[model samples]
Structures are given as structure tokens and as C-alpha cells.
Target: MVTRKGEQTKALILEKASKLFNSQGYRASSISDIMHETGLRKGGIYNHFENKEEIMLSAFSFSIDTMSHFFSEAMAGKQGCMERLLSIISVFEGIAERELFPGGCPIMNAAIEADDADLLLQEKVREAMDGLLGMVRNLVQEGIKKGEVKQGVDPEFVATVFISTLEGALALSKLYKNQEYMKRAVHHLRSFLAQNCA
Candidate 1:
């Protein structure tokens, strides 16, 4: 029973900390902030995590899992590469609309926050992004293997372009607090996929 309660407390800390970190830049969010967010004093938080860095790592992992869950749900019935990729775009659009992960993309936020200053966090961000890009690349490859996408289409190029476009548009949308940028991105990506991937 004590073990279960401890686990519960740890989860609570992670949930609140992740939201706090995402909303406020991770580097700017202090231990005091996390303590306040979790409604736990220093000891209470330290009981679960050794330090701010540890909490940041765990919270970042939690964010990645949360994002992945949304993607999996969006792609549930999607079969074709274009279909799956569009679903992915819809997820990004949903982000711009604040339907998910309210503070913005975790990977993007973390990358900007930790760039050049925090080696560990930077590595984590890179790994997360690689996974995201790989997912797109694999989908494109599958499309070609099934003859749904044009022969000789470069999955590598497609993945890079696909993610950069969506992330860039998402950043713009977030900056303007308008969903139009994401909507425009989705529009162009759909057409790009249909024409180029065809």
C-alpha cells in the first residue's frame, strides 16, 4: 500500500511538472515552481526525484509518451502513407488549436530551451525528434513498397521536408496565436503529398 501510494505521488509530481515545464520554458522553471505546481514541498518532491534535471528528464519522457499516444490514435485506421501522414498533420493542427499538449510541442520547446546549454536535455530532444522523423520516413517507405507512392520517391527527403514544414508552421501558429498557419500548412502538405507522392 505504501509502495502504491509512493508511485501515485511520483506520478502526480510528473504530471504537474511536465505541464509546468512545457508552459514555462524548462530552463526557466525552477524547483520552487515545480514544488508549487505539485503542491509539494521540497522534501516531498525530492522524495521522488533527485533533482530538477531528473524531474525534467522524466517529465520530458512523459510528454513524448503523451504525444505518441495522440499520434497513434490519429493513425488508427490510416493505411496509406499519405493518409497516415495527413493524420499526423491533423495532430499538429490540433496542437495549434490547443486540442492537445497546451504549451506547444515538447520536442520543439525542449530543443529551444536546452540548445547548447544542457547536453543531456539536448540529447534527449534529438532522440525524440529522430523517432518522429523516422516514423514519417517509414510511412513513406511503406507507401512506396505498396506502390501507393511514386517509385524513386526519396523517403529521407520526404521525412525531412514533411516534419520541417509542419514544425515551422506550428511555430508560426503558436507565435501568432492563430490556427491559420497550421491550416495553411496542412493545406499545402496535402496537395504536396498528392502531387509529389503520386
Candidate 2:
């Protein structure tokens, strides 16, 4: 019974922690802040998580799950691979332009801020990126089969370009706190896709 309760507490911590990290960033959000937000004592927090890094990992996983669900749903009911690809872009463009995260893309934000100094965070970021790239790669391969994308077009290459542009757009938008940069980035991405597909 106690063990189950402990697990429940840990899960609760992760849910709240993920939201806090997403909104305030990993650096700006402290354990004390989490404690305050969850109304859980420090002892209660430390009982489950060893440190902030562990919480961060949990938050990242949470973000991945959330993001994957959104993309997967968007991909559903789409016929051509190219259509699925466009839908993916549409999701990102809508989210980015609308300020979905209020802190921007959590994975991109974490990658830029924590990649160099934090190895664990970097690994999580890499995993998150691979997840994103995998979606694009799968769609591109499908497009090739349907003659939507060019035959010689490399799925991996296209995925990489797509991921890079989206991340760059998020970074630039965050830096200037301006949505125009993100809009321009997505426009360029759409143009690139059009050129490749045509």
C-alpha cells in the first residue's frame, strides 16, 4: 500500500514537473518551485527523484509523449505520404505561431540550453530529435512509394532538413520573442517541400 502510494506521488510529481519545466524552463524552475507547485515537501520529492536531473528526464519523456500523440493524430486519416508530411508541418506551424508551449518547443528549448553542459539532458534531446526525425522519415518513404516526393530524395536528408528548420525557427523566435521569424521559417520550409515534391 505504501509502495503504491509512493508510486502515485512520483507520478504526480512528474506530471506537475513536466508542466513547470515546459512553462518556466529547466533552469528557471527550481525544485523549490516544484515543491511549491505540487504542495509536496522536499522530503516527498527527494523520496522519489534523486535530483533535478531526474525530474528533467521525466519532464522530457512527458513532453515526448505529448508531442508524439499530437503528430500521430495528425497523421491519421491522411492518404498520401506527402499529405501526411504537409499535415505534420501544419501542426508545427500552427503550434509555433500560436505559442503552444508558452515557452516554445520544449525539446528545442532544452537542446539549445542544456546540450553542452548536461550530458543526460543532451541524450534526452537526441532521443527527442530522433523521434521527430523518424516521423518525417517514415512519411517521406511513403511519399516516395506514392510518387509524391521525388524518387531520389533521401528520407533521412529530408527529415534532417525539416527538423533543423523547425528547431532553428523555434530558437530564433524565442530569442527575439517574435512570431514573424517562426512564420518565415515555416514559409521557407513549405517552399522547400513544394520544390522537392514538384
Candidate 3:
């Protein structure tokens, strides 16, 4: 059985590993990197996780949870589908401005790195993406029910466009080392929503 102290140590390792993996990418971050960040020896890490893959899985969960909390906080006072959806973009823009995760969105980073490799990591990314898509879809559906959004709008299509646009914009922003890409994407998204949503 793992002791309370052991659980604390494991959580610490996961927290540090999440940041390191997000900044360095999964394959680029080695055990030594995690050890250096967490100040734990190999034995300590191994005592909690069976391997690096195990650590990575936990770290990804940590990253996703953190991102979810950030979005929730951003959406707290916002109402309606348009407001909630725009809040997501606003949060992403804030993340870019503040360098919240160092490298960028953890899910996007992991998805790009794990594509065509690391099936397990890829699956985790897919689940995270699905969760995000579902959130957007639910918001849109709620808006339709409340008469806040256009009755004919397809929640699935809107969610897809919103997510894909943001992801693509984030990638370009990171690639070009400029926030304008994200800002422009947000502007276009807002315009699209204004035209489509009520």
C-alpha cells in the first residue's frame, strides 16, 4: 500500500513532470529531466510509477485538469453559448500572453508529438479533445434551447469549427512566435459567431 507521504511525493512528481513534458514534449523529456525537475532519484520515481510512460500518463492528466480549471475560471460569469465559446478563445489568448504552460496548450503539443506514434498518449489526447468538443456542443445546445442561439445551428459543426480554428491558430502562433495569429483567429471566430449565433 502507498503511504500518504508516498502519494504526496507522487503528486509532486506528476506536477513537475507535467510542466516539463508540456515544455519539452514527451519524447524529448527524459527520466533524468523529470528527476532534475522533481529533485527525485530514479528509485523514488520508480517506486510510484512503473515506467516513464506511466509518469507521462499521469502528467498528461495533470495538464488536462489544469487546462480545464483555467477554462472553467474563465467561463465562470459568462452565460450563453457565444459568451462561453468566446471565453475559451479569450483564455487561450491569455495563455499565450502569459505563457501559462511555457510551450502552449498541453493537449495540442502532445497531439502533435504523439501523432502516428505513442498510441496510448494519442488516445489520451483524443479523449481530452472529445471532452472539449462535448463542452462546446453542450453549450451550443443549451443556447439553442434557451433561444440564445440560432435554432438551425448545428452544435457539432460549430464545436468542430471552433476547436479546429483555435488549435490551428495556436499552432501557427507558436510556430511563428507571434500572438497576432491567435488574435486574428479570435477575431474571425467572434465574427463567425456573431453572424451565426443569435
Candidate 4:
């Protein structure tokens, strides 16, 4: 029973920590920052996590789960592959507009920071990215099967282009503090989807 309660507390800490990490880069966020955000003492935090890295791993998982939930929610009730894909783009636009994570895409954030620095975290980021790309590829393939997309269209190539385009747009949007970049990307992507996928 005590262990169960401890697990719950740890989960709560992870949730809070994930938001902080997403909002502020990992290196910029410290244990003290997590403690402050969670209203837990350092000892309380340490009691749940072995160290900052452990907390970060858990937090990254939490962030990914949160993003997945958002994607699922946005895709719900949308019919066909193109609609579903556009729904994802809409979700990204919403995230940028509302600062849903307050620091743009969590996967991108961690990937940029963890590249060649932390093997474990980098692996986790790579896995998350792979899953995302797989989702896009699967959607494109499904569309082809349903005769919604061009039959000869290469799903892997489409997925890669789609992911890279959005990531680039997101980076530029965040860097320029302008939503127009994301908007234009979405528009162009929609056009591509209609022309090639639809």
C-alpha cells in the first residue's frame, strides 16, 4: 500500500517534471526547478527518482504519451487518411498557437538537445520519432489501399517529406516567433497531400 502511494507520487512528479522539461529545455531545468514546480522537497524528489537523468527519462515518456493523446484526440471522428493526416497538422498548429506544451514539440526539443550527448535519451527520442514516421507511413499506405492516394506514391518518401517539412517549419516558427511559418507549411503540406495523396 505504501509502495502504491509512492508510485502515485512519483507519477505526479513525472507529470509535472515532463511539462517543465517540455517548456524549458532539459539542461535549463534542474532538480531544484522540478522541486519548485512540484512543490516537493529535494528529498521527496530523490526518494521517487534515483537522479535527474532518471527523472528526465520518465518525463520524456510522459511527454510522448501526452502528445500521443493529443494526436489521437485530434484524429478522432476524422474520416479517411488525408483527413486524419491534416488533423495532425491542425494539432501541430494548435500546439503552436496555444503553446500546448509551452516549448513546441517535445520530441524535437529533446532530439535537438540530446543529440550525441545522452545516448539513452537520444535512443528514446529516436524511438519516438520512428513511431511518428511509422504513423505517417501507415496512413499513406492505407490511403493508397483505399484508392484515396495515388497508387504509385511511395509511402516512405511521403512520410519522410511530411515529417521533415513540419519539423523544419516548427523550428523556423519557434525561432522567428511567428506562426506564419507553420501556417504556410500546413498549407503547402495540405496541397501536397491533395495532389499526391488524395
Candidate 5:
């Protein structure tokens, strides 16, 4: 069993590593980078993790969890599909405005970098993406059942468009060192949701 201090150390390591991996390409980030970021010696880090791959994946999961926490906070007490969806978009906007991840959305960052990365890493990205999509799809279905969304709207398509547009806009916003790109996407999304889902 892990001791309390051990658990704390592991969490610290994951937190630092997640930021490092997101800022630097995961594959490009070496064990030395993680050690440097966490201020932990090789033995210190290796004590909690079996290998670099373990650390990498764990860190990736940590990043996703961070984003999920924000989503949960934003959507709390919200009712109906449009409100919930707008809350989600607001969360994404906050990501850019607050500079939540200096390297952009970790899932998109890792997935884009995973083209030449390990197959396991690629598969992990797919699983993470699928989970995000599933959440949005479920929200759309619930909205449909509640008679908020237009009849026969496809959950799969809504999830894809919502995520894809927001992610692309985020990247552009980051690249240009401006928030207007994200604001524009959010505006367009709000209009689309109001028309189609209201």
C-alpha cells in the first residue's frame, strides 16, 4: 500500500509532468525533463512509476481530469441542452483566457503530436477523445428527450462539430497570441446552439 506522503509525491509528479508533457511534446519530453520539472531525482520519480510510459500516460490522464473538473464546475446547476452546452463553451473560453494549459488543450496537443508517437500513446488519445465525445453526445440525447433540441438532431454529429470547432479556434487563438479567435468561435457556437437546439 502507498503511504500518504507517497501518494502526495505521486500526485505532485503527475501534475508537473502533465504540464511539461503538454508544453513540450510528450515523446520529445524525456525522463530528465520530468525530473527537472518535478524537482525529483530519478529514484524519487521511479519509485512511484514503473517506467516513463507509465508516467506519460498517468500525466495525460491528469491533464484530462483537470479539464473535466472545470467542465463540472461550469455546468453545475445548469438545466436544458442550450444552457449546458453554453456552459461548456464558456469553460473552453476560460481555458484560453486563463491560460489553463500554456501549450493548449492537452488532449488536442497530445493527439496531434501522437502521429509519430508510440501506438499505446495514440490509443490512449483515442480513448480520451472518445470519452469527451460521449459526454457531449449524452448531453444532446438528454436535451432531445427533454424536447429542447430539434427533433432527430444527431448526437454524434453535434459532439463532433462542437469539439472540433472549439479546438480549432483555441489553436488559432493561441498561435496568434489573441483571444478574439476563441471569442469568435464561441459567438458562432452560441448562435448555432440557439437556433438548432433551442
Candidate 6:
């Protein structure tokens, strides 16, 4: 069983670390910075995670879990695989518009910041991204099975486009600090889906 205080501490650390990692990038953020953000000492921080890499891994996990939960919740009452796919896409679009992450999508940020530099981080990013795209691909495949999506549609290709479009929107939004670009990208993406999807 987990103690309430211990769980609280862990949650607090993860929250601060996620935000700091998002804003500062993994290369720039330090354990000390995390400590400062959480108002915890070195010992307190280290007590939960062994090193910065460990914290990074945990933060990545936290982000994936959070996003997955959001998607699941958003699609709870919705029916049809196409609608489900749109709901998933819409949730991410909402996140982009809200600038949910100070750094952008955690997986995307990790891919750009650490994928080439750190193989471990790269693997983590790859796994997380693959998992998300896999969800989309499965949804699309289900739609095809139900005769909802276009016949002969390549689920993987569709998933890739969806992922790419969202990531591109995020990059643009962060660059311009404007949701308009993201909104437009999302609009175009949705239009493409509506036009192409059967």
C-alpha cells in the first residue's frame, strides 16, 4: 500500500518535473531546477528518482498516461470508430490550442531534444509515439472493418498522417505562440479526414 504523503510527494515531484522538462527541455533542466520548482531538497528529489534520466523516464510515463486518460475519457460516450478517431484527434488539437505543455507534446519534445543525443531517451520516445499511433491505427482499422472508413485505407498511413499533422501543428504553435496556426492546421487535418475517410 502507498502512503498518502509518499504518493503526494511523488505526484508533486512528477508534476513539477513534467512542467520544467517541458519548458526547459531535458538538456537544460537539472535536478536542482526540479528541486527548486518543487521546493524540495536534493535528498527529497533523489529519494524518488535515482538520477535525471530516471526522472525523465518517469515524466514521460506520466505524460503518456495523462494523455491516454484524456483520450479515453473524451471518447467514452462516443460511438463509431471514425468518431472515436476524431475525438482522439480533437483532444490533441485542444491541447495544442491551449498550449497544454509549455514545451509542447512531451513525446515530440523528447524526440527533438534527446532522441538523437540519448539512445535511451530516444527509445522511450519511440515507444511512446508508437503506442499512440498504434491506437490511431487500430481505431482506423476498426472503422474499416465496420465499413466506416474507406476501403483499402492503410491504417498505418492514416495514423502517420494524423500524428504528423498534430506534431507539425504543435511545432508551429510553439514557434509563433499563436493558436491560430494550430487551429488552421487542425481544421485542414479534420477536413482531410472527413474527405478521405469513408
> Of the candidates shown, which would achieve the greatest TM-score relative to the real structure?
1
lDDT, candidate 2, 1-198, per-residue tens: 469889888888988888888778888899999999899999999988898998999888987787788777887898776668777877677567644555678787788778577988899888888888998998888888888888899999989998888878877776787878778877887888888774
lDDT of 2 at 80: 78
Report the lDDT of model 4 for residue 121. Answer: 98
Q: Give the alpha carbon lDDT tens digit for every residue of 1-198 in model 1.
A: 459889999999999999899989888899999888888899999988888899999999999999999999999988788889989998898887877977889889998888677889999999999999999999999999988899988999999998999999989988988888888888888898989665
Model 5 scores worst on lDDT over the 10 consecutive residues at 94-103
The TM-scores, one per candidate, come to 0.96, 0.86, 0.94, 0.95, 0.94, 0.92
Quantify all predictions' global Cα lDDT against the true fold.
0.90, 0.82, 0.89, 0.89, 0.89, 0.84
Q: Flag regions of model 1 displaced more than 4 Å.
A: none
Of candidates 5 and 1, the better by TM-score: 1
Runs of candidate 2 exceeding 4 Å displacement: 1-8
Task: Write down the TM-score for model 6.
Answer: 0.92
Worst 10-residue lDDT window for candidate 3 reads 94-103
Q: Where does the lowest 10-residue lDDT sum fall in candidate 6?
A: 94-103
Q: Per-residue alpha-carbon lDDT of model 5 for 47-94, expressed as tens digits?
A: 999999999889999999998898898899998889889888987887
- Please give the distance, in angstroms, between residue 170's alpha carbon in candidate 5 and its true position after superposition: 0.9
Compute the lDDT for candidate 4.
0.89
- Clashing residue pairs, backbone N/CA/C < 3 A, model 6: none
User: What are the clash counts of all predictions, listed in order?
Assistant: 0, 0, 0, 0, 0, 0
Model 6: per-residue Cα lDDT over 1-198, one tens digit each? 668997899999998888888778888998889989999999988877888899998987888787788888889998887688778777777777654556678888888887566888889889999998999899889888888888888999989988898888888888988888778877887787787667
For 64-126, candidate 3 gives per-residue lDDT tens digits of: 999999899999998788888888888788767645777888888898888666889999999
* Candidate 3 vs. true structure, TM-score: 0.94
Which stretches in model 4 have alpha-carbon errors above 4 Å? Answer: 1-4
Off by over 4 Å in 6: none
| Candidate 3 segments exceeding 4 Å error | none
Model 2, residue 148: C-alpha shift (Å): 1.8
